[model samples]
Target: MIGSPEHFHQLEKSLARKLGIAAFQSGLQVLRNDRGWRENEISIDYIWMVTIDHSYSGEGGIFAIKYKESKFREKVNPGELVQGIFTNKDEISQIYTETGTTDLRGIFDFNLFEGSQGITLDGVSYTIRISGQNIDTFISLSNPNTDSWKKWEAEIWALGNRMALASGNKEMINLFQ
Candidate 1:
């Protein structure tokens, strides 16, 4: 039920707010909810953290896209909601921003590894995954092919290009190139 026109529209506005764009407009996208996963009843949601801005002192970084999915049963109306406001001090690490901790390393390979490296671009520190370039392969290997996966890959690619142009760090630029 995700990635309909309405969903993208919502994401665009969410991005604008996080990036501090009062009147922002661009052909920018963040992620796509893979259909195979979405169809699975157990698939609660997916979340991603993309850098929007960073601290001037370089102590930490800020993320604009705290992508999330909330489950709702059929015929349930969650109601309208305001956009989320995030800051560097806030706990933006995991989708579950809870205090409890559990050792999931042995449970899933996906959670065990730090797939992406953190980089600063336009004062925004993006967590770039080296394997994201091959996200297509990952999807194909793990799930059925779908347009949603293509969009997800494209969005990550676009994010890398944008990050490269805004970043002064050669190492960060090189990661994408």
Candidate 2:
């Protein structure tokens, strides 16, 4: 699940109350959206576009483009690939770092992964990863039981709070104190 920073915290609080657990009391983790790839270069093989809902065309929605090398495809891929969130198609055309055709096309929804599972409350954990000025968040659920969990958990919390403060998230800043 990916959403705005506010939505991330709100969902955390809601889940905590419903599950009777504090798994996500810590602030969400921050991740860099642009994976340090040079502009206009397809350094990675895979590009993923993330959306919260089925709506393909909209402003102020989160989209992610990730890089992963493909084993089968080795040919040069063409066209420009944008690497950040944009408020509108105009913004994408104006501020796009990559160079190529500047044509705006209809956005389409695609599934990177799909599955179904039964619900279980046992050993559940919620972890949020925010990227790009709180424009996107990736929430992960897992059951972790490791000796170093305590140490890393504290570190992650501190880092998350710092990121939230830097992003000017007033709610997260208040929670930090």
Candidate 3:
């Protein structure tokens, strides 16, 4: 049920309704960390900051793809893809122009934590942390629970793959496969 057509359809509908967008399938870009690191030190985990662009409006939302463990040194390998909502000031502009606000929690129904880092979707519990420059926010899964990570990753990949398929992006679809 993770990557099923029905699942993808529901996800598209939910995202479009939440983000106030007409369509979720548009342009997809997967960005990898190109920065260098020490030999012994582990570089930043393979985080694919996927940008989903709207075909007609050019507006889109950014989603961060992380892994349960850092396997590949540089390339993105097949593993648990932890999905996160990443939004900075610049990226916020691309997502919301009419609202003119960068507070995602205000726009979306995201439950905020007092001191801890996590989010509750439906009944599942997942960690969430917001960090970056002023007005820049990144909601990532930092929970120690791999099960939760796996489920979240599957949903995200399904959505990502569906978008890629709609846009006819073989490269993006290949990554998920």
Candidate achieving the largest lDDT: 3
| Deviation of model 3 at 174, angstroms | 1.2
Q: Rank the candidates by TM-score, best first.
A: 3, 2, 1
lDDT of each: 0.29, 0.32, 0.34
Instruction: Write the residue-wise lDDT of candidate 2 on 118-164 in tens digits.
Output: 44333334333433322443654333234244343344345334443
Question: Ten-residue segment with the worst summed lDDT in candidate 2?
Answer: 88-97
Tens digit of per-residue lDDT, candidate 1, span 1-177: 122334334443554444443322322223224442332112112122333223342211211222223333442322221122222222222111221122211111232222333332433232321111123111111221234433443454454444444554453444333
For each of the candidates, give the backbone clash count.
0, 0, 2
lDDT for 173 in candidate 1 is 43
RMSD of 1: 17.7
Find the number of clashing residue pairs for candidate 2. 0
| Candidate 3 clash figure, as a count | 2
Off by over 4 Å in 2: 1-39, 42-124, 128-146, 174-177
TM-score of 1: 0.24
Cα lDDT tens digits for candidate 3, 46-159 = 222333322222323334322233334464434333333322222232121121112222222333342334553332222222222223232433222344445544554465
